[model samples]
Structure formats: C-alpha cells, structure tokens
Target: MSVIEEERVRGGVFKDINAEDEDQQPTVIESLCMTCYENGSTRLLLTKIPFFKEIIISSFTCPHCNWTNTEIQSAGRIQEQGVLYTLQVKTKEDMNREVVKSDSASTRIPQLDFEIPAFTQNGSLSTIEGLLDRAVAGLEQDQPIRKATDPVVAEKIEEFIQRLKKLKEVEKEFTLIIDDPSGNSFIENPFAPQKDMALTVAHYKRTPEHNAALGIEVEEEENDEKPGSDLDTMRNEVLVFNTNCPECNAPANTNMKLMILYVVNCEIWRSHRRAGNQNNLTDPSDMSRDLLKSETCSVLIPELEFELGMAALGGKFTTLEGLLKDIKDLIVSKNPFMCGDSSTADRAEKLELFGQKIDKIIAGEMDVHIILDDPAGNSYLQNVYAPDPDPEMKIEKYTRTFEQNEDLGLNDMKTEGYAEK
Candidate 1:
C-alpha cells in the first residue's frame, strides 16, 4: 500500500539553445565570377551604417558581369522580434527623422509609382532625404528602367523626384512608408513626442518566409539520405558535401556517396581474339561503378539556381555561397607537396592561405569558384545539367595516356585485326 505512488510533472521537452555565429567583417579580394568563373572580377563592400547604432552593410558586385547582390546585418546581438514604421509626411520637418533600411526591406510611396524595392542595393542608413537621393542615383545608372514615355507621365515622374528632394526644404504632402521584415529597419522614435503628430510604430510577428528572405531562419534537415536515379535529373542540381554538415558538424561520408551518383561509366572492352590476355567474363555495371569510385577526377560546382544547401548555418546564401568547401578539401590531395626542403614548406603555407579563402566562400562570406581537376575523367561534381556545368564552371577533357588505358584494362588490340605480340 505504501509503494503505490508515481509522479508526473512536465509534459514536453525543454531545449537549451546557443546563439548563432556572428557575421564576419565584410571581406574583399580578387575573386572569380559567380555566373562564369572566367575572371576574378568580383568585389565585396562592407561599411558601418552611420546612425543605425551598430549595424553593418555588405554588398557584392562583379564589374565584369551582371551580378549585383546586397545584404544588411546587425552588428549587435540578436533581436527578439521585428518592427515596422509608417510616417505621414505633410511637412518638411518630418523628412529629417533618422531611418534605418536593410537590404531586404521595401520602401514605398503610394501616391507615386515610386519605390526602392527590396534586395536592390547595399542597404543604407540615412535620413528620408538621403534615401530619395539614392533612388534617383539608381535610376540614372540603370539604362533599362521602363517608364511611361508619354509626356504627362514622364513629367510626373520627374516631379516626384523633385518633391522627394525638397522634402526637407519645402513642405509637401507625401507618405514615406518603410516595411522591414527583418525588424532591422527603424525610424527615429524619441521617447518624448516633439510634434502634434506622432510616428506610427508597430511590432508584428515575423513569418517563416519573411525570416528566410532576411537570412535568419532556422531549419532542420528532413531528407538527407543518398538520392537514387540520376542525380542531375532536375537540371543537374544536387548538394555535394565534401565535409560533414558545415553547420551541424556532421561526420563526413569520405566520398562513399560518389559511386551511386554517376553520369557515365568508363570500362575496358577486350578483343575477341585476345583471349590469352583477358578474362572471359565482363560486367558493365562493375566497370561503371568502379569508374565512378576508383578514378581520380575533379568535381565542378557551377552557379546553382537555388541557394546551395546551408542548413548548417542559420541563414542561407543568396549568390555568394557554393559547394567550394568540398572542392577545396579535394584540392589538398591533388595539390601535394613535392619531396624537398624549404620550398615545400613555403608551398604548404601558400596552400593553407588559399584554403582559407575557400572557407570564406563556404560560409557565404564571399563569392568564388569551385574547380575539381581530375585527369581520370571519372570524377564529377554530381548533378551537373550541362557538360559545361554552370556558366562559370570550366571543364577540360584530356586524351587518356597509354599507361592510364592499361591501368583500366582497356589496351586490348586483337578483336579482329592486331594483337600486340
């Protein structure tokens, strides 16, 4: 009777979580093209926003190509939630209020068909007047912004720009609206109301889609199992991992997954007459699988249409990240040190530096190329749609050497004519 007591209190699991990895300082170096790795023409822009207390802006552009990408990251700790602000600009004084706009945030003027759309440029920290000036600058640089060529509409567009500039100097009626899904955007809200009209400030719950667009969303892997069938069936797109999960620190498969993910098989076909030199039985499956697994070849990662998988990091890459991590790791084995002395150590130092640059790419810290150069022709980047891979990926096919042919057992000469004596 005394031993009949059991207790239950808690219902679900309680979890302890750590903070996310802070963003590294904006980095710039001579880097290859993201769409076409033909030239190292990409540049990274990092600047601290002036008034947005502890926020930084990072952007990417390839002067040689048509690639423009930008992002705004908080230099401070994580925000608990996001906020939105709306201001009715009826007088000139309202234009001087401090404003914070992240790269993903969208700005609008309902009265006029004018807005600086989200993800357009490196995010800016400026007053309302400054933002308008930026918008004007953008239009001038862009040669293809279609507008109503009709005289009336064209004149109106020009008038809108003019009003935006005179926002601080002359009193006018316009609505300055800012919507930031990241909660990083802000309009000056002093504790004391200085005017008869107060700024409308609201805090709202951020949806998953909004979080993803801002690069702060967290996700767990659902189906990471080895895929079957052709890896490149969907336009040659697949995530090829060289290291374990970069975010989760998952264990590496050590290239075990390569055999099943194949494009073409290379094999030896013995001559019917060269019975003395060859074994009687042949297996195409075995040869193909062997070609995929045994041959030493480079893997080429082209510019992916989707964000290359970054479940390891909380935020995903837009255009600056790729599968360069695996490519760089593969480089070590091929880029060996020749047996020597001081020269070898020097080479190792340079290689280490090069690897560091590659790591930046895997972290989405910068943009670069992923090149795998294996002479065997058996290795592939897996799931490449075209022979050229992406616009930037480079591929070279070499004639197999006599010794290489012999190693693969392809040197048979006497099917109907000549056998080596």
Candidate 2:
C-alpha cells in the first residue's frame, strides 16, 4: 500500500475510538428549570458505585437564573426487606464516613431529637460532614426571607443551625439513624469484612402502607374470599396466616380467632379490652400478654389521662411490654422538634415524664388501667385463663356509635354499589 493510504487508515481508527469515549460521558439534555421557568441543561450520568448497586446521577443547571439541582436514583429494583442503620458518632473521624442516603430514607439524630423526614430531600452520596453542611446551607438559604417576615422564628432557626454545625465537630457523642423502607441506603463501615462496633444494621419487613407508598401492589389473602360466604361456620375458628417479623423479617404464622358476632337480627362488633381490676392493678407483672393492636385500635390509660390515637403506633403483633417500649422510643428518642422548637419544650418535658411512667408500667411499678379500644373490632389481648374467664379481667362487646363509624371512615363507604350510572 502507498504511505499516504496507510496514514489515512491509522487516523480513521483513532477517530472512531475518540467518538466511543465521547458517547460514554454524561449526556447533556435540554430540561425545564422549576426555579426560573426557563430552558436548562441537565447532565445525566449512569454509573455504578463501588461495593454498591448501579445509580443514575443528574445535575441540572439553568443559565437564565443560575438555578442548579442535583439528584441520585437507584437503577436497581427495590429490595425485598427494609433496612435501618444506626451509627454512633463518637469521634470527629466518624464525620468523614461515607453515606448513601436514598430519597425514601429518614434520618434522625437522637442527641438533638431531630429528624429529616423521608422525601424532604433528594438522595445523596456524601460524607457525614457533607450532609450536615448541606443541611446548614438549606436552613440558611431561607433565613433572609424568614427574618424579614418573622424575626422570632428566624432567630430560633439560626440557633438550631449553629447547633447542627457543631455536630460536625463531634464535641459530644450522638446517635445517627437512617431508616429506609426501600432498603437501599447505606453508611460506610470503616471495618470492612468485619462488623463495625459503632454501626448497627437492622432489616425489617415493609408494611402494607409502605408498599403502597412505593407503588407496589401487594397480594392480600382477604381478596381471595367470595362476595358472600358462610359467616356462622367461620366463628371461633383459628385462622392461620403467614407473616414476617417486622424487626427481623423472619417468617412466622399469625393465628387470628374469629370472635365477632354477626347475628342475623343484631350486628354487634366485638371490641374488648382486658382491664385490670382495682386489686390487680397493683401487680402488673403477669400482665405481659400477647397483644394484637391493629391500626384501628386506640390505647388509653384513664389514670394517666393518656390517650394514644390509632395512627400513633400503627399495627403491631407484640406483647404489652414490647408495645410500651415502642411508645417510649417514639416519644423520647424519635421526636423531630424536641430540641429546635421552643413551644415543644414544655410538651417534650411532659413526654419525658410520660415515658418515665411507661417505664414504671413496664416494670410493674405503676397502677394504671390500660384500655385498647378498636372501632373496627380487630385488636386482641390474650386471656391468660383461656377456657375460663379471669376474675381480674373485664371484657365488653358493644355496637359502635355513629361518631366511631365516622372516625373509621365507614360512614362514607358504600359497600353495596349499584354498578350503574
């Protein structure tokens, strides 16, 4: 071949290689900026993280108003079980640990009793100190507007922002918790291949509501039943169903007894609370019974004047002691505004006292009457004396009132539809 032809062939090969490299780089596409209502360019990069799954990172910038935003999304499917990570930040070095916080993950700081609710911020892959810096910047961004309109609120926020900055210094030990129902978030364990003493990981089964939030359709056993079935024959029958433990996702069988009365003449919804008699109220050590508190159940303690609504704790198939422990944890540790807001300081103090009383009840030190009122008639407190009625326990079943039906959203429901226009 001629020397000129050989040089042209070699140049063509290098040009093709350069084109392939350009294709692998981030793609800049036209996007509409929400801030400026102008056309912007978004650079999209699909890449895999080391020791993690694939992710897509997008950076949008608007030249009109200089608006910018960045977000990260997991390219993989949702995990089977949810995950919660608890890391104890005891040293300044811990602030440098890497973290992968998905958009669905909720973050909490136990020392400040502050929380960043899920979906409030975009997913981020950054160090602990970087997260804090982002939070501070976000808070400061709105300070000018707040100071102009409401100086009092802005002052409180400024003080809270300073405290958030101090957390990066690690002057005091604090617990950082990241809870993700999608099971995609992570915190770097400095000790790889071995367990890090400062980090604790827990896997939990996602609830039906959580599944719905993620746009997942979960198949329920109740949907298999026909429109009309034999109601009398199903009474007192122990219905066994499969479930996983919320904390560990271990397979378990939940046996539910048919205790409702659906008689032809009178429809009575059975809702029972095994209350302690005046004499037995002094001793609640043996009161640790299996409790199935449905989402519709409301718990009340008349003596303490404490009434916990149905939505406060959600559904749980745990023991009485376990339920009390959960209540304590929710109020004392997971309170979001416990430290920042001044108005809640008084309420926080009361909650701390209430937590102390709950501890006494758990330890069988307090005399309080616990009532589980379920308008839907789904809650159950196991009877220690199975076949016979216990002298210390009282059970009642009555028809629900109109107000109760309204609260349950049953009044708005039309079960027997015409299916006609």
Candidate 3:
C-alpha cells in the first residue's frame, strides 16, 4: 500500500501497541531535505490525544546536515468558535505542561508585554519550557549578525533574552495567553476531569473582520424590503442580535429596540411633544434605567455644549451612572494633558469644571438635560414603566439626515435589491 493510504488505514484501525516494541513502529519514508539537498527520513505519526482530538505529528531528520525538525497538524475539523487560553505559570510543573500552538494562534506574555503574533511561527506541539527554549534559540540565531552591525540593538535584545531565560526559574508569577481565532490551539490541563484554578478558557464567536481574515464569506439574510421597515413592524418587540461582549470576547447577544422612545419627568406635569428635556431636568430616582449605547450612537449634552460622536466609547451596556462615569473617564482620566505640565491653567480649569458638572449629574446633585441621538436607532434607555408610556421620560424617533446616514455607512447599504448587485 502507498504510504498515504497505509497511514490513513492505520489511523482508522486501532491496535494495542506496546511502547517497548520496536518492530511495531511506523515505517519512515525517505524524503529529500530542502535545506541540505540530501536524502532524509520523514516519519508521520497519527495519534489521538486523551480528551483531545486526533493530531498528526511529523518529524524530519537529514543525516547529511544533521538537521532535525518536528511539527504537528490537527486532523480534526476547526472548532465553531475561537478559543482563548489563559494560564498562570507560577511553578516548575506549569512550565512542563504541553501546549498545542496552531499557526493562527497568538501567544502573549502579559507581564513582559511581549506577543508572538499569529502566522509568525509554524504549528508547534511543545511544552512551555520547550517553547521558551525555541524562542531563545530564534533570538540567539540573529544575535551574532546584529552584534557585528548594530551593537546597541543587539545589546538590548540580549537583555530581553536574559529576561525570558529568567522566567524558566519560576521565581515570579507570570501569565501566558494563547488566543487562537481558528480554535485549534490548546494548553494541557494538569488536573484532568477537574478544573484548573489557574487556567481560564474562553470561547468567542469570530468577528466579521476575523471571518474575512480566515477567508469566510458570510451572506446577509434575504429581505424583501429595507431593514428599517422590518424593524418598524417589530418595534414593540425586543430585538436580539449576535455580538461579542467587549470585556470578555465571549459570544453574547445584544437586546435592542428600533423605535421605542422613553420620556420621563419627575413632577406630575403633562408634556406636549418635545425633542428633549431642556429645562430643570430633575433626577427620576424611581426610574433607574439601563442604557445600551451602540457604537454608532452619539451622546449630546446641550447644557455643556458637548457632543460625543460615534466610536468614542464603543458599544456599552451599563447603568446610567456607569455610562456617565465612563464618559468622565474618557474625558478626564484618559486625557494625558488634563493634569500634566503640557496643559495650561485656563485649559485645566475648564476641564476641571466640566468634570465637576458631570460628577454632579452622576451624583444626581444637578439637574441637566442629556440626549442620546442614535442615527441607527439602536441606542436604548430603560422605561421602568414598560407596556405603558413613561410619564417622565420622552422617547422620540426621527428619520436620519443625509449626513447622519453617510456617517453611519447607510448611504452605501443596499437594503433592497442587493442580491442583484
């Protein structure tokens, strides 16, 4: 039988083979070594790992150059969701744990702030220690040349290499993260059947960008009319769509509404139609609401003359207080010049006052108007009184302007007759 055919047949048929039996070893095929241009022996072993899928392990040895190489390939189909493996390596035993790092997996050392990006290395079936050894080897390989040409750069690399070497001592705790969009990477669990306290495994749905990178073409669901029309029909019903949680890249669903508007007032006052509350916007403490501000949405505070545009704070699902705090952080905490010498007294004073006003709004100490103008109509504010109109809050829906539609990329969207294009 041909080597390929025999290999397949061997994989299908299970046999009780003893490790000590030399005669039962799989036959090695003679192959040409690309590097030495000499005949080498190549061995392919098809094996199933315990509690894991089947994998093909291949080894190549070229006697002419004394060159040896090993690699692994998964025989199983790709998983439906991407996986992220976080391992805390605190002890020597942790370094000995086996890891299956696929070519598409990115390895990150959080403490070191170092990352080995995906596709930079080939698939490896190695222990944590072995992985580090291979990395050191790679770094050392280019060092001599670097030392001769760029001594300073080489010196820096040598220092970094030393730091990586010290990690093998297990003197300090460190975290190793393996993120595989292909869902093929794995880090062995020492305590099988029982969960490892130091290890965290998360499965996430691949984003549209990830799908594109993986050469996946996603077809949009067929619709007869504009999506807005469908949403209008189902305005009363809560709409759920697939989305990944920002904090943890886990697969999650975002519940939203298309046209439901909430209008609220603290006092018993009847209101005619108003775009937003402009005067004495008192806190409706009873109306504690959850807010879902989509990335496409904009926040407007006319009192402060502040307009937070799209993509400022990515899609968030939080309490009104939490949302305000995030806004404060974005404007104050995250701004480098807010406190540093780079900021002038006048600028600093303005930001300080602005922050205090936001703080008051968050504390419910001040009465100020806040508006969420969502062009895509995905932003939501909770109505404590659902199934009935909120006496205090006003929810209004308006057609987006040409500029808003263009900004939201809706101008290029062909909701109807898209299949023809």
Give the whole-model CA lDDT for all candidates, comma-separated: 0.46, 0.71, 0.70
Q: Better model by TM-score, 1 or 3? A: 3
What is candidate 1's lDDT per residue for 1-421, written digit by digit as tens? 1121111012011111112213432356665667665454333333222223245444556666767655455543234355566788765656665577877678888766667777876666567877877787665443334353456655666666676667556455777778777666777542211122556654455678877776775776543444574543533444555543322222344333323432223345222111000111112111111112112332333332111111111232222223344334433322212122212464466556656755554554645344433334434333233455333333455465675455334455323423344
What ranges in model 3 sit over 4 Å off? 1-24, 50-52, 224-421
Find the candidate with the highest TM-score and give its number: 3
Question: lDDT tens string, model 3, 1-421?
Answer: 5564455445452222224444445558999999889999999766544223456668999999999988877654456668888999999989988788977789889898888888788788788998888888888988999999999999999999999999999899999999988887878655432246898776566889878766678899755656577656886888899764442223468898756444343234222221222123477462247788887666777777776655556788987777778877766654434432234575567667778988888777877766777766777887767889767567775556666665555456544454584
Q: What is the C-alpha RMSD of each candidate to the true structure, in Å?
A: 27.8, 17.5, 17.9
lDDT digits (tens) for residues 196-288 of candidate 2? 689877656689978987789987655244535765557657889976444222346888987744422223322322221221345675457
Which scores greater on lDDT, model 1 or model 2? 2
User: In model 1, which range of ten residues has the least summed lDDT?
Assistant: 272-281
- Candidate 2 lDDT: 0.71
Q: Report the Cα lDDT for candidate 3.
A: 0.70
Return whichever of 1 and 3 wins on lDDT: 3
Summed backbone clashes in each candidate are 7, 0, 10
lDDT of 3 at 364: 75
